[model samples]
Target chain A: MRVLGVDPGLTRCGVGVVEGVAGRPLTMVGVGVVRTPADAELGQRLVAIERGIEAWLDEHRPEFVAVERVFSQHNVRTVMGTAQASAVAMLCAARRGIPVALHTPSEVKAAVTGSGRADKAQVGAMVTRLLRLAEPPKPADAADALALAICHIWRAPAQNRLQQAVAQHALKGPIR
Target chain B: MRVLGVDPGLTRCGVGVVEGVAGRPLTMVGVGVVRTPADAELGQRLVAIERGIEAWLDEHRPEFVAVERVFSQHNVRTVMGTAQASAVAMLCAARRGIPVALHTPSEVKAAVTGSGRADKAQVGAMVTRLLRLAEPPKPADAADALALAICHIWRAPAQNRLQQAVAQHALKGPIR
Candidate 1:
């Protein structure tokens, strides 16, 4: 399966596309960042990010999209921008009928480096080695996005099974 | 001018439309909420919000969209969802080239009730009085949205003049 992972931000949104499934080698299709000027209006910045993600979706045609699930940050403004950009990415995927998965930062790190507490450099090295790249993707955000794609590709099957089980249990109605 | 105000939320997004310019009486064009169940997936909920806002914009054809700017809340999850929903509202307006404005919660309250610290009941009471409603809009969110629209209609002219002045000053190329 092909997945496009988004590391969402207002000023710089990182995008990476990977092709693979679990128990197989993953290939990097593309990686880049979409940037909007800091001076731009919030709405304009969001529009730019939306257009960028739409262009990537059109070009890559990934079957699934993975976005970083935003948690709290010390800086409220930063967290707000990240959350906004994340929503734009999900909206683009939903508009294109692509399934979207959200991976937490620790989840991505754990999947890529076998340690939830792995540092950025460790995750970056793992991504480079796993994807067999000549060098690690620059600007941290790019490497983070690749990690998210890898994480989603590895976790989706099991997650899908869990979702199915929940659905089945719901259909069976509450314990009476 | 006509304005559509959006009080964004994941579970229940409030929408209100009003028609008028500064120094003139405003008319209530419409008021409602777009609800998505809490049990729905996040992406699905966002998509539902996008669709709801799009439908409102298409039907009302508002000249401007006023969204409540998200602020940091004690509850991180609540703030994140509000930010996401706000982005969706702004995107709908930006897509259609309708001017978008953001009003703070305090600004909305102050505009309608003459105090930034006014409580919800005070704002609701003022909204009812201003709109000549027999009773305040239900669910508080709807009233808050109307207050936002009213605030924008009142504030937009001065804000535009200020923006124009800044642009003009910048064009003159920094004073020697």
Candidate 2:
């Protein structure tokens, strides 16, 4: 399964593509960050993100798009930007019929490093080792994006099945 | 100046259009809520919002889009949804080359009512009076949407000039 992971942010959105099933070794197809100017208006920044994510989708054509689920952090303003960027990523994928999955920061860390509490350096080191790359992806955000894809790929088979069932049910009609 | 105001929400996105400029009687061109299933996936709901906003833009062809600015509050989850929805609204407007403006809830209240701390009912009543409506728009969100348009229209003329200068500078290139 080819999956694209996105660590969404306004200043630097990280994107990475990983290809392979859960059991087999995964191949890193690409890794990069989409950066927008800090001083730009909020609306223009979002439009830039949409264009960036759309370009990635057009190039990689991943079967699934994995995005880091945003949570309320102490920095409310920063969190709002993250939430907005993530929305753009998901919208781009969903528009093209690509399945989108959301994984928490801790979940991505646990998937790469043994512990959910692992720090960024540890997660980056493990990602480098797992992907057999000469060095870790730069900007930390890029590494986190790859981790999100790894987490989605490593998720239990049963969980994926349940998610598929939910997606199918959603298509049937509105639950309300 | 024709303005389309959006009160962005995942479940019920309120949209209203007002035509005319400051110091003149404003006309209510349209008002309604875009409802999406509560149980839908986040990406799907965003897509629905984009479609709804697009339809409104097509029908009204407002020169400016005014959206309520999202601020963090006690409810983290709800605030994230609001931020995301606002992002989508802004994106739709920006993509079409229509200028988008953001008005805080307090600003909207102050523009229509004498006080910024006015309650929803008070704001609604004032909106009805300002627009010469027979009754307050249904659903508090719809009224709030109109208030946003009114607020944008009533912003100090100097501020609009400053904003236009900044927007023009942004088009030149990345400030950073």
Candidate 3:
């Protein structure tokens, strides 16, 4: 599957597109960041985010989008910004009629590092080694995004089975 | 200014494109809902959102995009869906180089009802009265979006002044 992974943030958003299936090394398609000036108005920053996502969508055309699910954080402002940024990404995928999956930070870390609590550096190193790349992906955000996609790949079987069961149940028609 | 207001949701997103300034009745240029099947995968839902936003952007070319900010909710799934929908709208604005403003529920309610605690029906009534529409905007979501644009207009003066003050302060250099 072609997966587009996203690390959503207010000032900078990391995006990575990769293609591969389980038990195989993923191929990197594209990776980049969308940046907004810290001093810009909220509205302006949101516009910058939107533009970046659209450009990425138009260029890469990934079949699936995977994003990190936001857990509760101490800073309300930061959480709000993160939520908004993530929302923008989800919307982008929706517009393209692609599927979107969300994984927790720990899940991604575990998928990339062998340990759920693995640190960033370790995860980055593992991603590079697993992908057989000479160098790790640039910027921490990019690596995190790639990890998210990897996590989705690892968890795809259970997700697919659940979806199939649900579809079958719905197809049975209304209960009397 | 032409402002596009969006009420982001999973099943149906209400959008309104209006043109006007503070203290003046805004003209409704266009209004509609972007919808997706509940049974659709998250990715497909996102694609629907993107197409809907793109269509609106193309039709109206609004200079500003106003969206209702997401708040904490009891349902994690609902919140996730809402966040994804909001992201699509934000990206749509950014791709076009248009500014986006996010308004809190309270802020919009206050703008339309003089009380931040006002309920949806009251806000809808005010939107009808303020815009001189023959009837209130259907589906509280659409009216709420219109209210958000009105809130932005009301708050623009203070925001502009703040921006100018910051600009002037930067010019003055470091304090002794």
Candidate 4:
């Protein structure tokens, strides 16, 4: 399956597209960032982000899109932005009828580095090794995006199973 | 100074603009959202977002932009989209040489409700009351956008002071 992984940030959003099939390693198709200025109108900045994502989607045309979920603490402003960003991704995927998946940081880290608490540097290192890259991915955001895609490929079955369980649970009125 | 606040999202990203002076309440000029189709291509949706934001900017030009910073946790896919959306906002501002400021969630909540733990409903209520609106803001995102603008106004002094301190700290480091 072709998958697109994203690492969201207001200033710098990273994107990576990969194509892979069952029992096959994923191949990198594209990776880059959408950046906004430090000084600009909020509406305008959001517009820029929308345009960048659109460009990436047009260029990559991945079948599935993956993104990181927000688990913030004690920061409403940050959380709001995160929620907003998340909504945007969902909207983008939904608009195109593409299935979107969300992965936790720990899940991605563990899938890539075999450690749930791996830091950015460690995760980057593992992604480089797993992908057998000549050089480590530049800018932490890009590396994170790549790792997210890997996590989806590695854990696709589990995720599908989990979704089924959740659906079943919901139908049964919450399994307490 | 004039400040614009954005509550960025995919389906609907809210934008609010306000004018502020020292020790004075910020005046609201405009508030609205950019709506995108959930079933459209990413590029088309982004184009819609860009057009929406541009229209807002053209109607009400604010001097500064305040956006909520995005922080991700579990869902990498979602975070990536959020990051891209945010990049759009930043890029729009940067292109016009407008100053952009990012605020954490807590800071915004604290500024609006005097409590960082306030929920979305609470924040929305407060924003409506503060703005003396005839009715509650249509969508939750719009209310949050207005709140962000208010938060920027209230926190401007502290932010400026913090920036100065950081600048001073950096200046004290060895010159390169």
Candidate 5:
């Protein structure tokens, strides 16, 4: 399976594409950042993000798009921008009928580094090792995006089964 | 001037269009709410918001879009959705090169009711009176949207002059 991961932010949105499935070696397809100037208007920034994300989707054509899930509990000032940027990523994917998945930061860390509480350096190191890159991707955001893509590819099978089970249960009606 | 105002939310995004300038009676061009199912996935909800906002823009062809400024200090659960929705609104306008303006809740209230702390009812009442509506628009969101359009109409003149002054000042040498 091919997946595109997005580490969303207003100033610099990280994007990474990976091709693989669970229990297999994954190959990195592409990785980059979408940057908007800080001095631009909020609307302009969002428009720029939309354009950048669209360009990625157009080139990669991944089966799924994975984005870092935003939590309001994070830094009060930055969380809003993160949420807004993620929304744009999701919207772009959804508009094209591409499936979008959100993985928590901890989930990405745990998936790659085997620990939910791993530090940035640890996560970056693990991502480098897993992707067989000579070195880790820069700016940390790029590494996080690859991590998210890896997590989604690894987890999607079990997640699909769980969703199917729930749907089947719903069809069976309430358990009285 | 024609302005489309948006009271942004995931479930119920309110929109209104008003025409005219400050010190003259404004005319209500349109008013409505765009709703998405609460049970839908977050990505789907955002897509619905984008479609709704785009439709409004296509129909109204307003010169500007005025959206409520979201604050992280608001209810944590809802604030993220508000910010996301507002981002979509701004994105739609900016993509079309229409200017987007943000008005805070207090600013909207103060512009219409002469009190920043005015209750919802007071703002609605004043909106109805100013628009010469038979009654206040239903759902506080819709009323607030019209209020935003009016606020922008009244404030845009002074805002343009201030922006121009700042631009010209930059062109000249610093005061020091």
Candidate 6:
């Protein structure tokens, strides 16, 4: 399966596409950053991010979209912007009928590095090795996006099976 | 000016429209809430909000759109949802080329009750009085939205003139 991962942010959003399945080597299809000027209006910035995500979707056509979930930050203002950017990514995927998954920072780190507390340097190194790249993707955010894509590709199969099983059980009829 | 005010929320988003100018009697144009099931997926909830806001924009065609600026709250999850909803509102307005403004809770309270520290009841009572309504709008969220509309109508003029002055000054060459 192909996955498009988004590391959502107000000033710099990262987009990465990975093509692979569990227990297989992944190939990097595309990677880039969508940057918006901090001085621009909030609405304008959001529109820019939305357009960027839409363009990526059109180009990559990934089977699944993974977004970094917004978690608490000491700086509330920054967190708010991150959350807004995350929402814009989700909206763009929903508009195109693409399934979206949210992965927490720790979840992504653990999936890539086998440690939920892995630092940026460790995650970067692991991502490079996993994708067999010449070097780690620049700006860290881009690498993070690739990491999310890898995490989803590895995790989603089990999740989908569980959901299917639940649905099938429900279809059998309600319990008395 | 006619203003569309949005009280952003994940489960129940309050929307209201009011028409009037500064120092003039205001009239209520519309008021309603857009609710999504609590168990709905995050992306689905956001799409519901987007559709609701789009419908409001198309139907009312208000001159201005006012959204509640999310502030820090104890509940991080709740705050994130609010921020997401707020973004969707802004996105809908920006897509339509409609001017949008964000008003803080304190600003709305101050505009309606002459006190930034005014309680919800005070703001609601004042909204009813200013709009010349027979009773306060039900579900405090609706009243808060109307207050935001009234606040923007009263505040935007001065803000717009200030922005225009800055732009004009910039065009006349840089100040020494």
Error of model 6, residue A81, in angstroms: 0.4
Candidate 2 chain B: worst 10 consecutive residues by lDDT?
Answer: B167-176
Just chain B of model 3: what TM-score? 0.86
Top candidate, metric DockQ: 2
Model 2 / residue B109 / CA error / Å? 0.8
Candidate 2 lDDT tens digits, B1-176: 78899999999999999988789899999999988898988899999999999999999998778999888874777888888899999988877667789888888888899798999999999989999999999999999999998888887767765765665555555334
Which one is best on TM-score? 2
All models, RMSD in angstroms: 5.6, 4.3, 7.6, 10.6, 6.0, 5.1
Rank the candidate models, highest TM-score first.
2, 5, 6, 1, 3, 4
List candidate 4 stretches off by more than 4 Å.
A74-82, A158-176, B1-176
lDDT (Cα, tens digit) per residue for candidate 5, span B57-136: 99999887899988898898999899899989988887776778889999999999999999999999999999999999
Candidate 3 residue spans exceeding 4 A from truth:
A1-4, A17-21, A24-34, A41-64, A72-75, A87-99, A132-138, A157-176, B19-21, B24-30, B73-77, B155-176
User: What TM-score would you give candidate 2 relative to the actual structure?
Assistant: 0.92
Per-candidate interface C-alpha RMSD?
5.8, 2.2, 7.0, 11.0, 6.4, 5.9
lDDT of 1 at B28: 91
Q: TM-score, each model?
A: 0.90, 0.92, 0.72, 0.52, 0.91, 0.91
Real contacts retained, model 3 = 0.44
Of the two candidates 4 and 5, the one with more favorable lDDT, higher being better, is: 5
lDDT for each candidate structure: 0.88, 0.88, 0.77, 0.72, 0.90, 0.88
- C-alpha DockQ for predicted model 5: 0.39
Q: What residue pairs are clashing in model 6?
A: none
For candidate 6, write residues A1-176 as lDDT tens digits.
88999999989899999998789899999998999888766776787788889889999998789999888665776888999999999998887778899999999999999999999999999989999999999889999999999999999988767766888989997779
TM-score of chain A of 1: 0.89
Colliding pairs, model 2: none
